[model samples]
Every structure is written in C-alpha cells, then in structure tokens.
Target: MGSAMNPPSMSEAKPALSRRRGRIQLLLIVLGVVGPMLLATGMYKLQFWVPEGRSYHGELIGNGQTRADLGVQADEQRWQILVTAPKDCAVDCQQLVYLARQIQISLGREAGRASHALAAAQPLSADYAARLDREYPQLQRYPLDAGVFARTTGDKAVPQLWIVDPHGNLVLRYEPNVKGKDLLNDLRHLLKLSNIG
Candidate 1:
C-alpha cells in the first residue's frame, strides 16, 4: 500500500515528458517560419514606391532654368533621350547612334513625341550629322560633361538612355543594349494616356 501511493518512477514519466517536449519543438518550428516572413513583408513595403531616398544620378540639368538651346524647350512637350558615348566612338559606339535613331522612327507617327542626345561623344561625319538633323532634328548634341557622365555610368556599363518627360522628370532608364522597338513601345505607352503637365 505504501509503494502504490508513491510517485511514478522516471521510466514511467518518460512518455509524458516526451509529449510535452514535442509540443514545444513544434511551436518553435512554427515561430521560426512566421517571424521571418513578417519581417520580409515590412521591409518590401519601405523599399519601393515611396519617396524615402530618390536622389538622382548625373548632373540634374534644366531643373530650374528652361532651355531652348537643347530643343528641350519649356513649351514643347517631348521625351529627352540622352546617351553617353566616348570621345571617339568605336564599333559599339556607332550602333548606339543608330539605336537612338531607330528608337525615334519606331515611334512611327508618334515620332514627334521624343528626342535624342549624344552626351560627350564627338561629332559625326558630315553626312551622318546631316542625316540625323534631317531625320530627327530634335535630337540635341552635347559634349559629355565628364563629371556627370561618371556619376551616371555604373560598374558594368553606362546607362544608354535617360528619358526626361515633358514636365521635366527623369523617369526612365533603358539599358545600353536595348533594342529600338522595345524602347519605342515603352514610349508609346507613356505618350498615350498622359495629358498631365
């Protein structure tokens, strides 16, 4: 009778202890998954579509003063396409010039909605310059300012195109190797629905 009233031995307690430990282990596994997922959601919300850190690259030109010299006139609405090329263009360099022209033509009837610029690259052949002027006179030519050019060009390569909308916002950057029709499609989308200043 005394032995019967005594507490159970360690061996007898093992199953209950194991069950309790398993419940705690399961709870920890759940928390490990849930804790990191909640953190990731919060971080994504803060990164994009918010104006937290929108400092621009390159010298932000024509921010205050309106310029007619670049044909980016205050009154005329156009998308300014700027390209960075070396002082003397190699084979890859000529393709970029051709690329800019094709992008404009690819705009088709909406071609007037955009313009191009060669930043820092040297002058072209008389025929080439004349042809560009004839075909897309809105395209401006500027010697690339070394300082601004460096800022926009990153580790891999220089950004091929930086487009400023009519209201003068740097909104789009297309990679250097982009095809003309693809960029034109993007431009068409921009031009269609937008009537805002």
Candidate 2:
C-alpha cells in the first residue's frame, strides 16, 4: 500500500512505549494502595494468640526452685504473680505485700483464673505465714532456699515482684518502691492485653 507505509517512524514509536509505561504505573499505584490494608489486618491478628516468647535470664539466684518441687506446678500453669520478699519484711516490704494482695483481690472474677504466691529471699518466719493466713488467706508464702536467692538477684535484695504468664513464662519483674496503683494498673494491663500460652 503506499510503499508498505515506510515502516512506522522512530518518533511515533515513543508514544506507544510511553502508553505501555503509563499502564505499568497505573498497576503499581493500585498495588501500593491495597498493600498497607492487608498488612494491617495481618498484624492485628499477630498481636493476639501469639505463643509465649518471653525470654528473660531470671536473676541468677543460688537455689531457684521451680513450682514442681514446691508442688505448685498446677498453680504456675495459670496466670500467676510471683514476688520475692526478704525474710524480715520491712515497712516498705509490707506496703508491696499489701499492694499485691489488693491486686489479686481486684482480679475479681479472674482471681481464680490467676494465682499469686510469695517467696521469701530468706526463710519464711512463722509470723509471716500466720499473717498471710490472716490477711491473704488465698496466698501461700514459702521458704525460698539460699540457692534460689543466688538464682535470683541475690541475698539481701528482696521485695521484688516477678510476673509469670499463664504459659509458665516469667514475663515482667518490677523494681522496688513501685506504687500500689502502678502495680495494679500493670497487672490489669497485662491481664487484659495478653492471651499468650
């Protein structure tokens, strides 16, 4: 037909290439718009139902014993709050104890769903056990031997609260002088937020 159309000119070839590039750009835009929404949904599910990933080098006490030897293995399976206090509890120590007791009680319907126990950096005195029986009938204070102290922080450093999750993993440990409200808030927060193993 007119000398075979003299082949399409190079100048005209660029427009066809530009149109193909435009189609690629449009496809990329669509993918970019949809990607974030899908990612967010996945992350939301990941936030819950995750297995216990708690990895903490528990304070190296000399003789840290597990709940098994103490016959508390079953209790440990539940969401348990474990605290180590000194053999001779001071005023501040008593304050933490009181705060912990309130926190356990505040669990209300979830109280049984969780277990809280106290370990003495030193041996538990008869008086301490009696007091626990009187005030916190539900809580049982046990004598954590010296090796346990070595496995933990150390001797003479006491009254620190360690939170153990339902999956028997040590999750959070609080420092000294933390307030009652702060502890209660943390306990509530952890209980509400995590449904881990």
Candidate 3:
C-alpha cells in the first residue's frame, strides 16, 4: 500500500516538473528572439549610438521658412534649386548661378523633376540679366527681400544654394564653396527618398 501511494505522488510530481520546464523553455525562447531587438531599439531611441554616416550634406534651416512666406512662386509639383546672390552677380555670383544650372542638368533623365530659380537682394545688371536668360532659359527669376534672407544668411549677402521641396518648403542651404559632387549626392538622395519632390 505504501509503494502504491508513492507511485501516484511520483506520477503527479512528474507532470508538475514537466510543466515548469516547459514554462522556462518558453521564457528563454521569447528572450532569445526579442532581447536583441529591444536593446537595439532602445539604444536607437536613446541616441546612445550615432549613425556611421549622414544622407544629406546641406545645412538645415531651423526656422522652417518656405517659398510661400518669402513671396517666391515655385512650381508646386517639382523640387526647386534656388540661387541667391547680391544685387549684382559678379564672378563669384555667376559661378553659383552656373553651379545651379549644372546641378539641374546633371539630373539627366530626372532633370525635369527639378526647376531652377535665381533671387537677388539687388537687381542684376542688364547685360548679366540678358546673359542669364540666354544661357539658362529654364531659370525662374525672383527678387528676394534682403531683410528676409539676411536673417538666415547673416549680415553679408553671400551667394547661397537652397533646396525647396514640392510644397515650397525651404529645407536645405549650402554654401557657394560646396562641391558639385556633394550637391549631386544630396539631390540624388532627396529624390530617392521623396515621392512628392
């Protein structure tokens, strides 16, 4: 009789042990799959690790100003490559203008996806204006407010390259010294990521 009772208790204990083992195995499997993912996500969110590289090369405009606010009429369906210079486009200014035109041209099959625009705080010389029209027939001209862009570019009216999205938002600004290759790389990346512009 004692042996019979012992056998029944042992049988019951076997099932309890089996269930405990199963629970532990399930917990370990969940941890194995989800642990790394959670750690990676937490690290990313916490900014504990920085990305190896950045996609865009231009300086971001923190104020979030747009073409509409500046009174520049841009194509609502295409990205804009905007060139800003002082009243008179001297050699340096002309170089920036040329850079803008070349950047648009370098887009190749996607060339039509972007449009070029020139803005000056002061009016350009008649001769230079005519030359610009003749050389870059696709360029759109706008008179920029010195006070408006001045706040962003500092006191001096240095020629600057600005990227405007389809919604007319002024997003990126690059210095005149920026390399053509850098401009191309940024534009390519923007076109790839953006469905609108």
RMSD values for the candidates in order, in angstroms, are 10.2, 8.5, 3.5
In terms of lDDT, model 1 sits at 0.61
* Position 78, candidate 1: lDDT: 76
Query: What ranges in model 1 sit over 4 Å off?
Result: 1-77, 121-138, 155-159
lDDT by residue for model 2 (1-197), tens: 87667467766888999999999999999889988777777768777544555433233223444443222234456777676665566665666677677778888877776767776655555886688788888775666554545544445465676666775555566666666666666667777777752
Question: Candidate 3, residues 1-197: lDDT per residue as tens digits?
Answer: 66766888889999999999999999999999999899899889997775767677898765878975554555557998888775467777788789889999999998888988888778889999899878889888888777766664565667878888888888888887888898888988889889885
* Comparing 2 and 3 on TM-score, the stronger one: 3
Which sequence of candidate numbers ranks them by TM-score, best first? 3, 2, 1
TM-score of each: 0.52, 0.61, 0.79
Each candidate's clash count: 1, 16, 1
Q: Pick the candidate with the highest TM-score.
A: 3
Cα-based lDDT at residue 187, candidate 1: 64
The reply for model 2, stretches above 4 Å from the true place, is 1-20, 23-75, 154-156
Best candidate, lDDT: 3
Q: Is 2 or 3 the stronger prediction by lDDT? A: 3
